[model samples]
Target: MKILIGNRNYSSWSLRPWLVLRHFEIPFEDEVLMLSGSGWREALQRRSPTGKVPVLIDGELAVAETIAIIEYLAEKFPDRAIWPRDQGDRALARSAAAEMHAGFSTLRSRAPMNLRASHPGKVDLDAVAGDLHRVETLWGSLLEKSGGPYLFGAFSAADAMFAPVATRLRTYELPVSDRVAGYVEAIYALPAFQDWLAKALQEPWVVDDDEIDVIQGRVAPGTLA
Candidate 1:
């Protein structure tokens, strides 16, 4: 199987399913498509049915969307424990993942995921306070219940979904409680995540749209060095 992804530094959506495959020891290859520059959009449109990155191509089947790709993987590999094994735990995991998929717009918009950049204080706390609270509440509750270094206790798909959020919290130096901070560290310590981070730091392409400095007007567009 092959997964088409965007630049490692800026493509949080792409990172989700990719992490699942890697963490579970699934065999797959990945291709990186530039997220910006001339013809990039057309390139994505040609490669992905949804005209987006992180499309999984397995033979004739192409899966668009992160959650869909993850579900497909779980279905294909039932022995892998892609989600929590218990029925109740599985439901909770899916619930949390779906929430992450649809919610957190305020935090997401204000602090776009950029693994290669660290801009503490760039985000306005007032703008994303509610979203941050929700994140802490959700993650804290899960961690407390699971007694985990991960949300579901063993690095499941739910953790994959929130991996980028952990990055965002750390990158922005957002205020988080001790428990939430520990959870973030656990995410960073994942070997799969570490591998992704190494590649992200080496990425050359920069998507201006996700650059906080540019968005905040502290750095002029196209002036990044």
Candidate 2:
């Protein structure tokens, strides 16, 4: 199997399913396509049915969307605990993952995921206050119930879905409870996440749209190094 991804520093969507594959010791290769510039769009059009990155290609089957890719992986590898093993816990995990997929627009827009950069105070707290509260509540409740270093006790697809959010909270220095902070640290400490972070820091390409400095007008476009 192969996963086509975008720039490591900026592609949160790509990181989700990739983490699952790596964390579960699944065998796969990955190819990086620049998120912008020179045939990137054309490449995506050719390879992806939806013209998006993080498409999973397994023989003739191509899976688009992060949630779909993860669900596919779980179905393909029944032995692996891709989600919580208990039926109730599995339902809760899936609900949270789906919420992540469809919600948190303000936080996501204001603080795009950029693993290599930190821009505290750049994001307007007022804009994302509600979203942050939701994050704290959701994560805190789940962590308390699961007694977790992760949302479902062990790192699962739900954590993979929120991994980028953890990065966003830290990168923007957003206010969160100690519980949420601990969960964020747990995400960073995952060996699979650490591997991804190492590659992300080394990436030469930058996606201007995802850079908070550029978005906030503090840094001129195309000026990032």
Candidate 3:
């Protein structure tokens, strides 16, 4: 199997399937197409019909979209246990993942995922506060219901689905409750997350336009990326 991903620093969508594969210890060849330059368009077109990153190519199947790729992986490798075995938990997990896939447009648009950002950048209050509230509510409600650690008590697809948003909230310094903050920290501390961070820190290409806005001017205080 081979997976094509965008630059590690700014591609939250790309990170989703990569992290899921990493966390599950699924062996796959990785082709990281460094972005922030003009060459990515041609490369992305060849790998992904939609000209997007994070395309998964297996022996005879090609999958795009993080959620779709993950679902395909789960079905193909049932032993990986990507989702819960229990029917109820699995159903809830799917629900959460679907919500993540479709909602949170506000936060995504205002606070683009830049793991290398200096500080918790300023929140676009008008554009993002509502989504922030909804996300916080989602985390709080899930944690309160599940009672600890991850949203579903174990590392499931739901966690994988929300991992990028956790990074986004950390980057933008969105207001979140203590429980949600801890949840975000947990996702950040995962070994897969650490691996991605380490790789991102080493990347040299930076999109000048997006790289221009540095609210705190020093890259997230003590952040790894």
Model 1: runs farther than 4 Å from truth? none
Task: Name the lDDT of candidate 2.
Answer: 0.94
Better of 1 and 3 by lDDT: 1
- Better-scoring candidate (TM-score), 1 or 3: 1
Model 2 residue runs over 4 Å out of place are none
- Tens digits of per-residue lDDT for model 1 on 1-225? 999999999999999999999999999999998889999999889999989989999999999999999999999999999999999999999999999999999999999999988799889999999999999899999999999999989999999999999999999999999999999999999999999999999987878899998898888888885
Candidate 2 TM-score to native: 0.98
- Looking at candidate 3, what is the lDDT of residue 113? 77
**Candidates 1 and 2: which is better by TM-score?**
1
Ranking by TM-score: 1, 2, 3
Scored by lDDT, model 1 comes in at 0.95
The digit string of per-residue lDDT tens for model 2 on 1-225 reads 999998999999999999999999999999998887778788889988999988999999999999999999999998999998999999999999999999999999999999988888889999999999999999999999999999989999999999999999989899999999999999999999999999999989877899887888888978887
Error of 2 at 220 (Å): 2.3
Model 2 steric clash pairs:
none
The candidate with the higher lDDT, 2 or 3, is 2
